[model samples]
Target: MKTFSAFAASKPIASLWDDAQAASMSEPELLLYRSNLLGSDLRITNFGGGNTSGKIDMPDPLTGQTAKVLWVKGSGGDLGSMKIDGFATLYMDKLQALKARYRGLAYEDEMVAMASHCTFNLNPRAASIDTALHAYIPKAHVDHMHPDAVIAIAASEHGEQLTRDIFQGELAWVPWQRPGFDLGVKLGDITRDHPNLKGLVLQNHGLFTWGNTSKECYENTVRVIAQANAWLAERSDVPAFGGAVRAPLDRQARLRVVERLVPSLRGKISGDGASGQRKQGHFDDRAEVLEFVCSQDLAPLAALGTSCPDHFLRTKIYPLVLAFDPERDNLDEVIDGLDGTLEQYREQYRAYYERCKRPNSPAMRDPNAVIYLIPGVGMLSFARDKTTARIASEFYINAINVMREAQRVDRYVGLPEQEAFDIEYWLLEEAKLQRMPKPKSLAGRIALVTGAAGGIGRATAERFLQEGACVLLADIDANALAQAEASLSERFGKDVVASAVTDVTNEVSVQASMAASLTHFGGLDLVVSNAGIASSAPVGDTSLELWNRNMDILATGYFLVARAAYRLLQEQGVGGSIVFVASKNGLVASAGAAAYCTAKAAEIHLARCLALEGAEHGIRVNVVNPDAVIRGSKIWDGKWKEERAATNKIATDDIEDFYRKRSMLKLSVLPEDIAEGVYFFASDLSAKSTGNILNVDAGNAGAFTR
Candidate 1:
């Protein structure tokens, strides 16, 4: 349980605010400056899990009048490199009217109306739940962040008090409220009370601040967080937790637990013994337990938050505590203890709800505890979904670290049990749950694949089609494209595959292909920018033509395809995925192939930018960088490949072996291997993943430093 110094955390927040304020001086470039701030903040966070907004006093379209409007982050847009449409415009007067009303209208109704106001725009996007909060704030620019360090602190027991003590006169503290209009009204009230507050600390949530300028807002946030970090460091010593270790639970025992728990969970949990217990199904093997002993000699469990308050809906608050004793080594006892703890947790939860309930509010279901505490070890969170489980585990680990530090200062101060309950059953969040769009895993799915004449692109397209998708296959060689289409038609019928004979390098051709995809498939679900010309040349002597050619086809081509896909996907009102077929060169440069390496690297960045931009539209984008995908097609005929082979002074036949041996695992990198990675990116399994670069290089990239 390592706790960061309060100084360390608070310093960045101060610096960021200063920077943001400085950037705000240029009003004409406000949009650009704000976008840059958004991008920087997004990069600071793991993904663009945070958001930002700006208040603009604009003239009304219907009348020659000036009125304020809130331009807030849209639903699917990434904070990093956000575009104009990534923001939804809400009538400021209407928002103010809603705020004044205070409590009558439901949060869901407010959200729907706010979202509907964007109808004037050609490409309308959904408003984020925080739109109301942004609208209520007085500042011109608003920024919200989910920085890892800040979240680490907020997820702890003493988060609220620590935050208050750290920020002191400079910040305002708001209790945890579900993000929406209700939160907006609550925040509005706080703003009225603390008119001069520079930033806000939302307990168990994230941080938010606003400024007359974007720079002020950004810098203030940074400074405030830094103060908290410094306070933490001054108070306590952070202990190092031991590294990850797998549990010794056997497959049979794991199966029994899954069987017992799955029925109680909301979603169907497969992959247990009944689903033929694959390696992926074994939770114990997948789980990592990090052990930390309390250095302060305090009760370790009391220091942390009750797992993550946010994860309460998914995994119940507390875990089954297993104390380590010399006499209890039997595995059966441990399992029975776990079951008994769950039973007790359920009964206690019901009692707690009964005590806290309002007259009209319905009682919540007795939640199953998500965590398991091992006396000698720390804690473990079990979730039906891997993502939820992972977030819960991380949250627990972070909370433990913060709690340890907080105890040294003023004793652990967690949210009141009632406060936690309020958040778990917040009406605004409940409204969001009800309004959640229906799942359309691959609904209205359409895909376009470059180099789809053969190999990985072909295989990926086939997989997409199998998952109820329509595909457009593009290839430079007309005959090859036709032949590929014919073959695919025989296997998947004529309506499933559309052929486009165009070089991906040509902007017009790329645009045409994308258009054809939309026309034929009715919409686009994915874009697999797989077309690439490989080249092997040392950096200094690499030919300009060869370099330019590689860039034109691989890097620029990916950009063009992604750009077109963005338009079509947004038009269709369905989010999509973009999978770039960058080689492992994108991750780690190979010995030769300077031109190829540079292009691939650029492609990877392109995917990241697109992912950020596309998020607001429910679009997800990721890259699959494979090493030595050589199941089909000869690159020898391509000029870049021929020159590279000659430069390397080795026959093309030796290239595959050179890469295969470089990897720790002596597995050949096949098209199928790369295709699977592409499929994962394109599927609903990766709903929360964007700007991710998955390596399907058979441990090659990880094994080799460069």
Candidate 2:
């Protein structure tokens, strides 16, 4: 095996397991540090795909006695950013004792219950299924990961022999066994027989390395994976671009194909909208998808299963191959062909499940293809949101790379279909589905928030996301727009949020922004017209330029956006909602705010007109009149705050307090408060309500309207 110690760039390695270094750290801190470090390495694992554990002694909260505990990575925790809560602390002896009685137990829910029973009552987080595999090793620290290099060899036809050759006698090999009590028991037996074993290679699964310290185990894993990569490099002569193409494709042409085909494919795989009308799935156009589509071996090579069967839950067994030619076919023609193609895929998927499913297996999963492989064009990932689509894309790209390398070393092979079915329908995964937090009020819905770079608009976007709605932020400020998009995407999955530069007053820009939303999310369900400038001026002094600017944005902007969004909703036959961010000044005139007041007033009245018109089509239009909500608001950013304070003869710092003290409740009106009112109208909670005016001003009696 090649050693990683000399390679500075291979991965950060610890030369030795220094007890003194470890003794200085707490158990949770040590585990968290190691878990984060492991998860940070993309080659080792991605997102929430791996598990790590340590056997330690801690005072049992229930008994106040020092007890041996197994701290394992908990289910539903992201290893890259985990904390103490991310681990489930279980009594190790109790887990070990279950082995004798686990002889004939089922590998699904029953196994899960037995494992859960081993966890301390205080640790409510569910332990990982692989906890038993770690526990069986009887080591201080154990690490299990599905690194791409390791999976390449592990999933090949000559995987076992190759593993033997690479590790020689340093690692023990376990034949393919579905991960559960049986697999754990087998591991225990192997460890007992070979007490000198440093690591294990589970065929078609992953790698496990154990050591006396977390550092040792982590280093061992890194070193072994490095060795696997070196071994493959020495043997495999696979060209990066596999196969010579019949026709070399242009990259720009391929991207055009994606732009044309993805929207159509998204529409084809959706649930029925209002009264059986068609809705569309979200599409994420990925560049890596082009690798397989442009490959010479696209046909046979793409037919291979995932990097491993464990990836089935994400990427599925196989991708859906669609034929597309940007130069030859129209998008409509491609979509017309898709109906029959998707039908075939569904039928085949159903049959595959029937052929491979065990007794009492869960119902077959939805037959929609997650990855669409276009021969001439690139690939597009389809899912309910962008994050899932991206994840599917990541797994498929890894699968393609792994299988390509495996074919170079030997013939590429995959886990048996039945084994894949079990993992796909594993009760643990099902239980995870069952345990999923109830869908938010607007889950699966989409919303577009204007002026989203800051303030009330930004809050509304966040609120929409919190309620399970995907939001596309539109702002004129390119820098702030990009920043907001990045921040929101980081918090939510990139799939759930997008951003576009929009000058709502400009017809072309407004139209393009709306079009981008449909392309990003497949459809639009809600529109929040909140973009405006705080151009406060008395009616006599208000210049024509200021009047037109305020009118174009506050009133005309709402009209342009609402008009476009209305057309989309009407075409999809799925009625949607529209909320205008009117101000208290719109209802009650304020001196030196004539331009602002008139524009907001016009905006509110326009919403009322749209509400009357939209009511016939089941679309709801409402207005939110909010008082000053200055925190983090672009409207409140820059000299606006200082300018407003100067007009009021008050210190800038006390401006928010002034607004707070003016309300009947003596509390400031918040952006979230306005968002709640918007949510009520956007959601089914106000299905029968239209032309409604929600005063979110902490009891602004003067702003009340009949």
Q: In angstroms, how far off is 594's CA in candidate 1? A: 47
TM-score of 2: 0.82
lDDT of 1 by residue, 1-706 (tens): 3343333434343343345455435442454455555456421342335567777767677775886767777775665667666777777677676545454544344554544654332337777667777777777887776554455456556667666666666777676666777777677678767889887767666677778866666666666656666565564454323221233334444333333332222111111211111100112222223333222332344423352344444435544454433135444455445445555766776787887776655557534556555433334454432333555555554455444444445454455677667766766557666686653344335678998986887888778776656678998878878888998888877756788987877888987786565334334567888887777777877788978998899888888888877876664444667888887777776676778888888998888888888889788989888776765744534554556456667676676676577677877888778888898998878879999878887786352434
TM-score of each: 0.50, 0.82
Report lDDT (CA) for all predictions: 0.61, 0.76
Candidate 1: how large is its RMSD?
Answer: 18.3
Q: On residues 1-706, what C-alpha lDDT tens digit does candidate 2 reach at each position?
A: 1111112224433233345766788876788777887887767776777889999988888789999999999877878888878999889889888876674645345766788778875779988777778888868988888877778778888888888898888888788887777777778789778888988888887888888877777788878877887776665444433653534246655555544454445545654621122233344334334545656667776666674765767788888877655446555676678778888888888999899887877787677777777765655666655566667777776676577667667777777778888889877778778787776678767799899987788888988898778898999999999998899889987878888999999888987777777666656788998888886656788899988888899989989999988876665445789999899988998877788889999998999999888887778999988889887677887666776787788999999999899889998877788888888888889988899898888877889895
Cα-based lDDT at residue 264, candidate 2: 46
Clashes counted in candidate 2 amount to: 2
